[model samples]
Target: MNSCATSFVFLRRSGYAGLLWVLLLSASANTLASPVSGTLSAVGSNTMAGLILRWGEALSQRHPDINLQFQASGSANAPSALITGTTRLGPMSRQMTDTERRAFTQRYGYPPLELKVARDALVVIVHRHNPLAELTRQQVDALFSTTRECGANAAINRWQELPATQDWPFGAIALHGRNSASGTYGLFQQRALCGGEFRPTLSQHPGASAVVAAVGESPGSIGYAGYHHLTPNVKAVSLINAEGQAIALSENSVQSGDYPLSRYLYLYVNAPPEQPLPTAEKALLDLIFSPEGQQIARSAGFVPLSETVRQQQAHW
Candidate 1:
């Protein structure tokens, strides 16, 4: 993730002159994380890496004396790092669990502060060539888990097994998903699996790209990842919630609560009683909520935090 800034260089339009244009160039992680002098560490959430690096670069220009660093391990690492005093800033794609919050309160005498950073749709993807139209919450439960709690689930394993109208001969469905460390993995279990455990056969990967890539390359494979990780070779399948309305995964759908798997990305910090957030942290969070920071987030494929959420972040 760190080297992504220099990995692929691309053209950004500098000026438009009808027929001829002055092209500007940019990096995937460019202008987002400028180098600075001090030491700082941000550990957690591979999903938030690109967006944070972009903000870090921009923050550096405004405060050269403060150096803010970040790590993109996985969502599960965030609360743990904060509890251990290993990182001041922990980014997460899901809400901290009760177990995680208990540990933080025991360690810090207060629950770690969480600020909603962005909105994301947790999407299930399969090879673009797959003819499947949509998946019901129950069907997804049956496909991914052993427990068939959702009314429609029947421990289905093949394309023809679904109650969908069209059935062509296809191999057994292949399941891929994030490993235990991913918040997405947990959220899916709760929502899609209806509190059921993931089947032992599910192939668990470390990050979103890996999950999406594996599914894209395998014709029969299906997997889930943040909306940002969807690739051209893979198509996001619409998911029907328990309410019976099928909704596509999109920023608007996620924002409007129509997307069943929509989730809030977060940042956890310790703002000791009225003492201002440490200077470096303050600068970073300000950039995060600023129009510029939110724009970068949008460009990275996340929905901006709602005005109500931003207003709450302001008060927090």
Candidate 2:
């Protein structure tokens, strides 16, 4: 059998614990030569801002000649940038929507190439001192959304409303969230809010760090942000699954999809049909899928793609 076949067999037997070695073999087998000099610019996804910045730093170290540029307005900006050909690489926290795909197809006669590079989960967090344990989907919706589109019968306004915090002295729950421009906001609205609108009182921040920071500072606070944004001042609230089991954030839970808010992080490339990817862009991808790149991802608190998924993206 070929090396790819061998890697798949190994993956089945060893799981993600052997992910690094499997990716190393695949990357070595298909490594792209370094480009002497060029600029690689990417736009979109503030949620991925830190991870991509780390990747760019690593890329710069390897190829001193390459200039790296990134803009992290939000995921919404990525599709437009790719469609306008303003950027060759677009890092997005979520997949492009159907309308965005159509627009790209109209502009380039082909859909943008989506490469799933990592996985993450959205975590609901509270100040460390809060004793509240887990929340059901309906409770999360009611707490954050005035519209309560997720079938929450009424608004959850105070700490005492939930059984876990009935004895707390807090009168009202302080809420924090991301602004409309963030993909994090969009995903939370869709999944947690059930396509509903947030309460008018929800404090919206420009980035994940800000949301996390706001939650950490407020004693009666509750908010949601990417799992990586967790800090010592705050703790994540376990989310109860449909089966009535509380699902805490963990490497295994996120990877296995037991985490309710699990999501894929992507790099949407503007490579057209019947052509090779640009040298700098291809080199960036090669490094991203390499062991070193995966290590950067893991260090940034994002989950690396499994070898099977890596194979599909590597060939893309």
Candidate 3:
């Protein structure tokens, strides 16, 4: 059998069995052919672009002929690309909406396959010098939204509006956030802003790193970005939980959904019904579902999926 067939057969049986073993064994034993060399391209979430590049680097070490090329436009670009058949892999930070799924189904006569690859959290950050610590949901809504749909009776504009910073010397809170094209923008709008519109004063950025940099530079500024983009120049603010306790971002908290902003990162594939996935895509996914891949996720500052979760999706 060809390398693709061998990988597909093994993956279908083993669920998320690590790809490292298969490649090493095939190379050392010379029983199976090596993975064919070619370029694999993907486009989507800037939040996940770095992680994917890291994975691609690892993949190239094993199959030197295989190269990876991708675009980190925004999560909104992923589904459209998949629909148009421009690319087979679509990495997204948010789940596909009903409309997006419908559009794919209409085009292909089936739904696109969504694979959960990792977990991440959208965190609120302030300049490290800022003494303010925790924020209530109402306060969060008031600070970033024009509609205050999260139930804040009043909008929070200046630093004094928050009781924790009422005596602080800071003036108006400069707001920063992701642009509408980003999945981070949509998720933050849905969860933090309660589906309300952002205030006109909010500075929109193209990527999470940009948002983090802006927050770090401006002493009175506040913004939200993926946890991986965190830096010492900024401090992640804890959110008040339902019990009125402060819940900080941690592996345990985000994994258990204790952190209100926690979310799953996804990779959408244009796998036609009953057809085997393309070799390049399957090999990359095999590595992603492996222990080494999870380690790469941790090193990159994103939470890896647990063993139990991997078992549940073995058929994928």
Candidate 4:
């Protein structure tokens, strides 16, 4: 009878140990299923402020535990912030220069992970009341260049001097542009002005919105900005090439490489997260390459990437 009791006691203890092991394993699995927690900070690209703000709001709704903060300063400050470890993500409207890329890699010991988020067309806007419907590349260049006849300070300041003048407005053309530090300014200098310097009379506005507002209020004024900011009071002029073909800016044209003024919008990140990114941050970026995110990008007046680009970004 004593030996039987010993055997029963052993069996009971063995069963208890097995149940404890099972309980521990279940707890571990539950912990793994929980979402990661942390904060994500991003800066730069005032041009992308509206879209990202909307994205952040949506992301926060799905992830109540994670914090996402953003700032809409000039794009030139983004790379600097990244190199100095002040921000984890940097949004830019223009591509990085070779010198800037080399400096960043030297400081961080790795190249940045660049993700193309959207595409924007550089839109030339004029007052809504203006009758000019299109502008040739040369004519646009002449308006911003300084020379004997077309300089900013020249006395022949009327729009009638341009090529198409049947119903031209008889007034001086006032120009408004972003400050030198703006990514839009850099893009305009390279693509529209053909690397030529801006004229003296070109007024420097604080931001793209200001440029749009200034142009909208002035009858003979002109300005350029991302197509997303075009207002009803401002008319977007069609760009004509040297061959006299008018090209409208649209997602179809931009994706087909037919829009000469379209440029990629980028989100620059560290090679690996220096500080742990919340699950929501990772998921938000993942969704950006998803079909749903692409749809949002299109609706916001930006071009979505092709399937090929989306596949390449999946690995990043």
User: Which residue pairs overlap in candidate 3's backbone?
Assistant: none
How do the residues 83-105 of candidate 1 rate in per-residue lDDT, one tens digit apiece?
Answer: 88898888887788899999999
Query: What TM-score does candidate 1 get on C-alpha atoms?
Result: 0.81
Error of 1 at 157 (Å): 1.8
Model 4 stretches with alpha carbons more than 4 Å out:
1-34, 147-156, 242-244, 273-281
lDDT of 3 by residue, 1-316 (tens): 4886677677768875567557655665542366457899998988888899999999887677778888988888999999999998999988999999999999999999899988999999999998889998889999999999989899999999888888778898999998886678888999999999999899999778889999999898999998888999999999997689999888988877789899999999999988887777777888888888888998989998877776554459
TM-score of each: 0.81, 0.85, 0.85, 0.80
| C-alpha RMSD values across all candidates | 8.9, 10.9, 8.5, 10.1
lDDT of 2 by residue, 174-249 (tens): 9999887677888999999999998888899977889889999888999999989889989999999999999998
Question: Which is better, 3 or 4, measured by lDDT?
Answer: 3
Error in Å for residue 178 of model 4 = 1.7
What are the per-residue Cα lDDT tens digits for candidate 4 across 1-316? 4764565567568787556555555655554665644677888888888777766766665554556688888788789888889987898888877887888999978788888887788889888888777877767777765542322233334677755544665567888888887788888887887777778898998778799999999887888888788889999888886566898766677765577688888999876546554466586787678787777787776888878887788667
Ranking by lDDT: 3, 2, 1, 4
Q: Candidate 4 — which pairs collide?
A: none
lDDT (0 to 1) per candidate: 0.79, 0.87, 0.87, 0.76
lDDT of 3 at 112: 90
